[model samples]
Target chain A: MRYGGDNRGRLLIIVLLVTSLFLITLDLRGVQVIDGLRTGTQTALTPVQKAGSWLVSPFRNFLSDVTHLGRTRNQMEKLTAENEKLRLTLQNRKTADAQLKQLKGVLNLAGTAGYEVVNAKVISQGSTTSFTQTITIDAGTSSGVRANMTVLSGYGLVGVVKYAYRDSALVQLASDPAFKIGARIAGTQQIGILSGQGTRKGVLQLLDNTTQVRKGDVLLARGSQNGRPFVPGVPIGEVTSVDNSPGAVTQTADVKFYTNFSTLGVVAVVVSGSSADPRDSLVPPKPRPTPLPTVTIYATPGAVEPTPTPTATK
Target chain B: MSLRRFFYSFPIFFTVFLLQEAVVTQMRLPAGGINLLLVVALIWAALSTPEIGALTGFGAGLMMDVSQTSPGPMGHWTLVLIIACYAIAFLGYGDDNIRGNPINIIFLVTIGVVAAQTVFLLLGMMLGQQVGSVSNIAFLLAGSAFWTAIISPLILKVISFFHANIFGMRSQL
Candidate 1:
């Protein structure tokens, strides 16, 4: 209830605010000192956080299960027989399919191209602030996981490992605005840079203006010299739409990713790709485009003109 | 600020921080996730003195920054939370009734969450992050604020019970 002028309290608040601003400035400026502090603190707390996660996950599961207990019980009893019958029916088919694919030289071979991978569990999704699109996996440096290692689900590329602690590591999702990959269009072999649009869809910027890419064309990572961060031929996504801006030097298109980041479960970390973090090749993020106020029409006879939609093309 | 107050409230902040990161964050809602820690900080700040409020907010924000998975400028949350806690404490300095009324706590939490999130978004944009369109950020802020408000009362009651039991004081509610 002390609302009166307290100079000491005011001074303390100012000091705290100033200190916070200083920390932010230092971090933004990429001060090596603060980076060390961040790394050290993160390393020290990883164990405690991991232990806390272990203790809390079961309780969380129990709470969720209880909430859906009635429906779950009803479905469980009904599905038990069906599950057994389906399991028996699919077992032989799965084995036969695997044998067939092995006999043929046409399998999505994960480690065929001199890259070693380790499977890791997606323990957590996103960050506490939720400002960045990232996830934490259970594997870390202890399990040969390191920074800049490519992470993927069964479908395709997910992201690259950003940081690795002793027992855990952080994976920056491919949908993060800052993420980019050098990719090539399947069949056409046209090179382009794929960047995240901070959503499910990514934007692929073609290197050549004249490059012809169509919808449903699968994009693959054009892995670097050693394939460190991104290995060659990993499926990224399929092109959904191409931007046809008149007289544009570089063409852009919207890509729908094969990996579903929302429900990411078991992901593998490619431990032996690059000697160094290969993130430098990615193009720097451009500022979000300001929305257009109006549209212009170019009327022409005997030619159908597509409506020009304002978009950020870089 | 009394030493007892800081010691007593810090645990609640830490516990809330852990739960926010571990449990609450896992339930990713459509319009981004709700920040349960911000609500806890606001409520705790409202109940304590300005110094305690500011300190608690700083601790909570620091924990969040540490636990965050991505690499961005640190202390953004710390700065936002500290200022928000200070403002909340200033506004409720003489309002003893906030501690007793769960509805008031919910309302304060809703407003506080929105204010903190606005500062967070603006600062994030300033730091060269391509944080989507204004409408999208606004939608997320409002959704998260609403979700935080909905759960503020229950969370506050639990924290209050813990604080009371630990300190041998009567529960605020």
Candidate 2:
């Protein structure tokens, strides 16, 4: 009897293993049955996972803080005064900066590489070991965010939206290998394709061999035909290194992106608009139109003008 | 095969799973995070019958597959973990010394983790997924195995406590 039980147990293991393999094969074959099962499982579990994650966030933060207590304390000691000073300074500077940016936006409206901007906040980050760099944002279709829309930060281009859920969207970072953006060397017409390097950085390839690109040259997105994925003139990154040899037919350059994908916070989704150069916003606004001088004129009974008014002429 | 044992052991399994996903993954330790689920599987295989071990592994693997940040096809991890747990359970079958000894437990856990990881990576490669280069993958596997082994002693204590209190099992393991 014991022997029979042992045999049955072994048989069960074999069956489970084989069944799992069969399922894996079916899934690999693009079977909709397995896909549906997997999606249902995910959709059903996502809420629970979200709630668990939310509940654990404070614990995670506390744990992180505890782990870095010593370093944090030392840094705090050093930065306390600086923080206080900077807080006051930044408070004042923030208002000025807002005013400045707003004024610049208005002046550059004509030059705006026109794209409607919808702001979003990052909800959560993907796992560190995830195959692709992606993030979930709090804004979605309700906020005019849609798949393939370009996300941007104050510094530069961020990524493209991959999936737009009801109240959230998944943004595939520019560092993802699957992502590609048409880009150009800033200040020049030289165009290249910006492709992710699978690392934090990116690469601009397919530059004309004759085009000379120096390190530190900025890169800007080359808007698509419809300008949905990338609005033209949005800063992408800066050239870190140029790989052009004397006999090479094509050139490539490594790009150091201005926007840090890992620490993304508030971002703007390019919803719709005419593509305008973001760089134009940095230019000082044209002096406010000089207010037309108030002129007072009186007509005599014979409709004679004030011909004796030498002061008016002055 | 005792329903009571299975029912009692389940909460322990669920707790470990939550720890693996919620806490361990968030640690960001220098050597990368330890696979707590792998350690749990090792403990389950050591203490339980092959059938039970396989079931536990399958359940854990399925949860992992579904909850992965970038999910792949389901059942890949399930197969890997089942095979790993069953093999380990078979190796230590009816051997109280092997099952109860810390050294044996550590060795089994290490081997089980390496086996599961290698199979998973190979399967991923077969499916045209670019798991990193072999050398890097091997390094990661070794590192994770070592970490799992390092924490196995603590995990084993927790498992033993649950086994004694919840299941009322007097088995040595």
Number of backbone clashes in candidate 2: 9
Using DockQ, give the best candidate's number.
1
* Residue lDDT tens for model 1, A203-271: 999999887889888888888666667777777888999999899889999999988787565677877
lDDT of 2 by residue, A239-280 (tens): 889887777777888888877665454677888746345643
Candidate 1, which CAPRI tier?
acceptable
Q: Assess every candidate by TM-score.
A: 0.77, 0.68
How does residue A133 of candidate 1 score in lDDT? 83
Candidate 1 i-RMS: 3.2
Question: Could you tell me which 10 consecutive residues in candidate 1 chain A have the lowest summed lDDT?
Answer: A277-286
- lDDT (C-alpha, whole model) for all candidates: 0.71, 0.66
TM-score of 2: 0.68
- Give the clashing residue pairs of candidate 1, or none: A228-A273, A228-A274
Each model's chain A TM-score: 0.68, 0.64
Best by TM-score: 1
